[model samples]
Target: MGSLGQHGSKGEIELRWYQGSFYWSRYKLILMNVRFESKSDIRPETLLVELMNFTMKETNYKRLCSTKTVSAVNDNFLGPTILVHKWDTFFANIHDRGKYGITIHWHGIRQLRNPWSDGLEKIMKCPVPSNTSFTQEIIFFIEEGTLWWHAHSDWSCTTIHGAIIILPALRTTYSFPKHYAEETIVPAKCYKGDVMTIIDEALTTGGDPKISDACTINGQPENLYDCSNIWNYISSTS
Candidate 1:
């Protein structure tokens, strides 16, 4: 999640965001293999622009000989900054390997005259192990657009994948409407039966769940100001 800049031999990046009342610094993010569950069950509005995150492993070509633990920090998310260093890479599993070794593929990028930098089987090397690690360098010169990163070694592909969006250069500016609306995100789960599951569970407990029957905005518990899990309102249609 570092910035994208010319840092001589090393690549350092930064990103920033405007919170409320003041500007807040957004940190670069690194995520492990965690299940991304959709509680709300609704695909929120996806904006035309996007952001991306990249992870590193010990067995990567660059880190193979090192003995250190890596962790993400705030500095990685800073915008108008350097996002990654040249030659930065990650290891991913192939189609259906036993998770023994992993492969690294740089999507939407061409390794400047270096085919070795291209992460492909039979052409390059085997996959990197889990406990062990590998080193990969970011290859610049790739155009910016809707892109993604994924595993190319084994079944690990199902989990070890993330987005890769290159932002517009600072020199350029994009136009937008003046009456833009802010976005809101919620978390929840929905099955084939809808909210009825709550009622069923309540009935199974020998009591009325007290859920509403129509579209509800923000509900409260016993007290209107309780602001807890109280069922406020319900929606007639989904």
Candidate 2:
């Protein structure tokens, strides 16, 4: 997943996966920050900070795989947007800098024997308290392809989620013919009003929360809305 900024500046990290490989030859670390301007309105804004140790052209796969720190933050959101290679080892030092407590779950990484890194709050361990950090080691023993990470507490996953791509290693053959290009799609919904308020109301009344006002593809809403003209123009032109 990429970053969605205050002025609608967009940033994305792309990973290409070949069919049947067990290692990755390239990796990029991305950091993102999302913020909600008003408590009642809850307009979410995003910022992306990319930290790279090396650079290579599109056709190359060498030197792209390495362990790096990828962190995402919001006033109310915290997690990592990861790009994992099959059979590679991943380590993350997650820190909760916000006022509330939180935990993260790797959506599809099969933690068959090791449940400690499963990231279930109170199931495996307690939530990481504010201003505290925890180190997690994720091993992609057998799984491959696309995965995601998000907050496991309450309704926070709505805006705190991102994509993970696992690619094949160098000299590895694919199960199928490799495509010319690859893309990651994240479908999400955003509410116009405060999400927590809606959740609280639902919990109190035992009813459905307020429906989301907008749907997004890759964190961008449809071009029909008033605030979406810039994106529409960019989409049309690009």
Candidate 3:
């Protein structure tokens, strides 16, 4: 139910496969909150996402080439996109494997009567310490449409964030006309260095963090990063 293979009969299976292609982590239904509705005995989908250190390859811009060491979820800068239905409950088992602490926050998700997963970090919940894991229960009862999930601890959100797509509940139909396909485009600023270090240096010096170098669409800087391209590398497959 993400950017591709989101319709027809095999869409669901394809999406799950896409999740599998990202990181081979163990996941299963662990707990069930009775308040969450049971449609066809729906159970929680446990997602085990790991936070670790890695290096991203050359994102050459103009005459510059770079290989930046950074921290990410499942070795990806843009973390995993969570696909779920309205009124469905899922668990995010976040394991922090980095040097510092971290926590995840689901943006635009309505956690009514369940504030534990709100992910306020120091305000509501503490950060998941390094080498430890924390399980967050997410139940969306009323909210829908394209949302996001990001790191709630310190400056981690700059590198750890992903999409959250909430579809219509079971036996429910969209009030408006439905499209045959969908696309998820994230318009963001492209930075060439370690964002966590950028912020940490800024905090220590009381200076503003590094300004974004390029504006990107779907994580690509288009011709802004490379000089020998016309339309970047975005392709459409039918």
Candidate 4:
């Protein structure tokens, strides 16, 4: 149900970057972009995320849980949660190990200096091709809270995403008391495909010509979401 890579965010860690590189032997992952493999409790480090055929069981509120296979980062059910300190700089190599190419967009963080790393497909750079890697320089200028990350490539992000938790820098404390316990929860929407199918049929019959083909899920096609936001929650731990 979960994958703990060599450089997971929790517990005692190993691996790190010297100058601006890493020891490739301890690496892992690739999604539409780089997955994270955190090391050292220090300010900066390079994380590895692999995107590949990831399979896991997801609970459906109305039915029994079923196992499904999809492209993922670091083989995690929900991509890994990236944990780092505020005002820190780290690197992540998004190695695409999936059937398709991808790009990673750090959802809301301000990349004032490293706009090139922004996963804006053609606007910034081409998608990281399958079986290749793209090194991203993540410089967090001003962000200190829970944010999200997802694939910026096509519909791939519909199944490849995760969360980013930025804590207070170094010896800094949060706004509230340290004694308060913290927890991270992922909220997902339960869907009914039948309704969308009705709408899709109406549009298809009335429209001059379908501008876009509807994506299929178990033989039924529907136009539900398009931002590829599905990737954001695909890699978080359950």
Most lDDT-accurate candidate: 3
Ranking by TM-score: 3, 2, 4, 1
**Candidate 4 per-residue lDDT over residues 181-214, each given as its tens digit:** 5555544322233323434666769854223333
The window of 10 residues in a row where model 4 has the poorest summed lDDT is 55-64
Which of 2 and 3 is ahead in lDDT? 3
To one decimal, what is the Cα RMSD in angstroms of model 1 from the true structure? 19.9
TM-score of every candidate? 0.35, 0.63, 0.68, 0.55
Candidate 4, lDDT over the whole model:
0.53
* TM-score of decoy 2: 0.63
Q: Per-residue CA lDDT of candidate 3, range 1-238, in tens?
A: 2221223343231223246644212111111222333334242232122222322221223311445555677766456677776766667877777777777788888676668878879876898887777787787667678898878877667667778887776666677898898877666566777667778899999999989876665445656566423254355422
lDDT of 1 at 98: 24
Ten-residue region with minimum lDDT total, candidate 2: 54-63
Q: Which stretches of candidate 1 lie above 4 Å from their native place?
A: 1-99, 174-238
76, model 2: CA deviation in Å? 12
